[model samples]
Target: MVRYSVLASGSTGNAILIQTDTTSILVDAGLSGKQIEKAMHEIGVSADCLDGIVITHEHQDHVKGAGILSRRYKIPVFCNQKTWDGMEHIVGEIKTGYQEIFCTGDRMEIGNLALESFAISHDAKDPVGYCVFAGNTKISVATDMGYVNAKMKQRIIDSDALIIEANHDVEMLRIGPYPWHLKQRILSDHGHLSNETAAEILTEVITANTQCVHLAHLSAENNMPVLAHMTVKTILEQEQFKVGQEFDLEITYPDKPTKLRSVRRR
Candidate 1:
């Protein structure tokens, strides 16, 4: 069985743990090493048990603890060449042989898990999302994307579960306290995805075999969990899809673990 958990997600920090019977991997280590260790322990996994750390980009919320984790545990860190260049200094010193670079669209095996990285439209250099396969199950992690394009749709189509960004409500963001430039950036084509946009994308990608959706990367100031959940649910309902009956919807927390799930292929 393939099990995963969103250890933390949002502007402050982000991390995800994916595991099978024999292998465990961390998708990102945004939090401090101590925080990541405690979170892993809460889920009954040891920090030392992690096999590798795969990074999405150089953004602080995504790479803050990656180098430390890898160095401390003597585990490999995987990313594209561009990401390594952008994040190397911030992640501090990683020993030789601990850096593994894989290009976007390339599928690589780490233990029993097969992972594919695809480009995402974001401000960070070489930002991407991941599709992980274990046995018959597939889980897609697509956050920090400005908008969902056709290529992204195809990449995540029919996934057993998906963790996608629902960063903010457009109106809230527009009227919120953030300065004009920052607001404009977030609303731009290469910035974070709004809740409405994420809902629209879900309508196209979600299917009978898709079991769960986790709304991630919510902005504490511009989005509330209830608002994000209802917005997506409303869109699905308008599409004639029953919320709980058709699939489960959840929201990831910024400060703690949201949910632990085991996704099985249909």
Candidate 2:
């Protein structure tokens, strides 16, 4: 079985800790180096235990502390060439050996897990989501997506666990304090997913095999924890799906880490 935690999830910063019996991977280090390390320590896992740091894109909220964590721990950083090129300047210098570049849709083995990167619609050079395979169990992490297309949908189906973005409430964002141009960017195809869209996608992809779902990357200004959770819960229940009984539903934080979560194998 695989265990995971959303170290922090929101527009502010994002990170996730993925662990198996033998391998430990930190998905993204959007927070400061000390902050990421502190989050890991709070979860009872030392930063030294991490085998690698996998990046999703070049966005500051996704790679701010990536370079620091890698430099401090001598851990390898995995990202596509395009993403690496975009983030190189921001992350500062990293040794060539510690830079592991892979293609957008390529699958690579890291320690005790097989991780596959899939393209996502986001406002970045080459943003992607991750699918991690631990033995027969699968854990998928997908956030910062604009909208889910057919290919993206196919990539996320039939997972034991899922961490997906439920960014903002459409109405809230539309009427909120953000400027018109900013709202337009968020509502565009290359923007972010609203709570309803995230619910619709989750409802479509959730199979009987899926054990849990974590709603991530929420907009603190336009989204509330209760609203995001209830929106998805209501939609799923409307489809005759039992929210908690069938599979656990969770919310991630922008400032703090979520509790460790794992799926029970069938």
Candidate 3:
């Protein structure tokens, strides 16, 4: 079995602690080492117990503190060659040469777990999301996506747990205070997923074994927790899916750290 928790999830920073029977991996260390340590401590895990750090992209919100955390903890950083090239200047060189490079379709073994990276519709050089397997359970982390493609949909199907993006509400963003260019970037094909778009995709991929739905990367100014949750809940309900029973839904935060989530296995 595998145990996991979202130490924090949002635009400010993001990090998830994934632990199997023998291995522990931190996915995206956007926060400082001290902040990550505090979050880990709250979840009853120590920083020294971490085995690796998996990066999704080279964006500042996803890799801001990646270098500091990897250096301080002496943990390996896994990402694609293009992603590495884009982030090398930001994260500097990995001292131990543990910077494992992998492509979108490549699969790697980390302790008892198997991880596969898949391409996502994002503006980065080689932005990708992850699907990890521990024992018989599968967990997918796919935030920062502009839209869901056919390949992405296939990758997320049958996932035991999913952490997808519900970045903004279209109405809220259209009338929000952001500049025109920023708004354009956000609504572009390479931008984040809107609430309606995420729900539509979930209807196509969600299964009976899908135990949890973690809504991540919400826009602080353009989105509200109540609206995001209500929009998703209503859509699922319309499809005859019951919340907290058939599936669980949650909205992740932007400013404060969230509790470590548990990934239940079948």
lDDT values for all models: 0.92, 0.91, 0.86
lDDT (tens digit, per residue) of candidate 2 on 30-87: 9999999889888888999889999999999999999988998899999999999999
Best by lDDT: 1
Cα-lDDT of candidate 2: 0.91
- lDDT string for model 1 (17-98, tens) is 9999888899988999889988888878888988899999999999999988998999899999999999988898889999
The weakest ten consecutive residues by lDDT in model 2 span 257-266
Models 1 onward score TM values of 0.98, 0.98, 0.96
Ranking by lDDT: 1, 2, 3
After TM-score superposition, the amount by which residue 141's alpha carbon in candidate 3 deviates from its true location, in angstroms, is 0.4
**Candidate 3 residues 1-266, lDDT tens each?**
67777777887888888888689998898877788888889878898888888999988777877788788888899999988898888887787687888878899988988999999988999999999998778999999998888999999887888889999999999999999898899999999999999998888888988988888888888899999999988898898888889778987775555565567566
